[model samples]
Target chain A: MSGEPANREPVDLAAKLASFGEHWSPRVVAGFNGHDVMVVKVQGEFVWHSHPETDDFFFVLKGRLTIRMREGDVTLLPGQLFVVPKGVEHCPVAEEETHLLLIEPAGTPNTGDPATAATKHAI
Target chain B: MSGEPANREPVDLAAKLASFGEHWSPRVVAGFNGHDVMVVKVQGEFVWHSHPETDDFFFVLKGRLTIRMREGDVTLLPGQLFVVPKGVEHCPVAEEETHLLLIEPAGTPNTGDPATAATKHAI
Candidate 1:
């Protein structure tokens, strides 16, 4: 993953998504301005959690993704994005396999709590 | 552009791109964690410049884009992205009409220099 200069090439989303298949395990594809650009695959419901310090950004790349919040549910398809504001408890669910691109502050845990967050690694 | 709660609904990239047709003028579609998610229609070559304080992000939504830099040129297509690191001079060019989604720190000027930057407004 680390070879050419970080800013020297383009990051192909489709190619990055194809490099992994593990559900819920996000792979860092790029970074910018103190944020990590990650791609993850999901098939079931994720934990209901909230990032107390940072907003969560989600862009659906394949299949359907529904982000359930206390206020309501926001369902997104390909080419759509939704941001879950900080401190809002939410869970993501996908009936079928789904792919996503997420942007969050660098080192932000996936589960909001460091103790329960999935281990993130660069692809 | 301000309507329902900012985080309550999804932002459709295609729909947002269709809502505007001005070249190089980016419309703010969403914001999170001090960054603005913008969409812009671009054609021709842009001024060569560099953001001294922050990195610049570019995601191609339609057509093609070529980011020219001192080191080399990186061309991108739909579903592809490239990040121009802070302090790196770059210029974006698109032979045909192109659509893009960009991420940058809130209030960052498009032209690097505030005096000549396009006045960015929310769509």
Candidate 2:
């Protein structure tokens, strides 16, 4: 068996979500392998943008999320996931308050442009 | 808005879990950034192993999962996650059938040994 390192603990997604109330701002919850697991609460439409260097992952935790692209819109409910390939410009909108889990490379900007992206806070 | 690529669709975790019944076998459900998102069903106990080069991520979807390390064990319930850092030898056990979501670098083995690892079937 491997020795557990100090501070290694399970992350409770629900508890993390409950700790914050801000919308659109993502909070870093856990990380591994150069990736950061983030949680965000969102409602309404977000700016259209594309991550030119990395794909964007979104897993709906509660409510509904609609990813709108030029071709069409993909709606996701809780327990569903969608991936937006790199360089694909899209917008995320939630008709109701929605909770989301996002997996992305560390330092990835939410708006694709670092200058305009919302600051990612660790929670 | 970004143009949606052909074959882009949301993945339902529940439906994917229901489609398979084998224990300890993982099915690749999605891929991005040289990483694979996999779903697995596990029960009983797994062999003690460690990934020498990559961290192991686990998110419990149903039932209970316990990751046993030399120092201690971490138990996870639905919506909980834990990351086993690289080179940490550990074993996963489940007294009841459990559904899990795992994220790791593509080609990483379940047993840490390629020859003994279960073949990852894409579903």
Off by over 4 Å in 1: A1-6, B1-6
Off by over 4 Å in 2: A1-6, B1-6
lDDT of candidate 2 over A4-38, digit per residue (tens): 47245789999999998999999999878888899
**Model 1 accuracy (lDDT, Cα):** 0.89
TM-score of candidate 1 chain A against the true chain A:
0.93
For residues B1-123, what per-residue lDDT tens digits would candidate 2 score against the true structure? 333472458899999999989999999988877888999999999999998888899999999999998778999999999989888888999999999999889999999999889999898
* Cα error, candidate 1, residue A87 (Å): 0.6
Q: Report, for every candidate in turn, its global Cα lDDT versus the true structure.
A: 0.89, 0.89
Worst 10 residues of 2 chain A by lDDT: A1-10
Clashes per candidate (backbone, < 3 Å): 0, 0
lDDT of 1 by residue, A19-73 (tens): 8888999988888888999999999999998888888899999999999987789
State which candidate has the highest TM-score: 2
Cα-based lDDT at residue A119, candidate 1: 87
**C-alpha DockQ of every model:** 0.47, 0.56
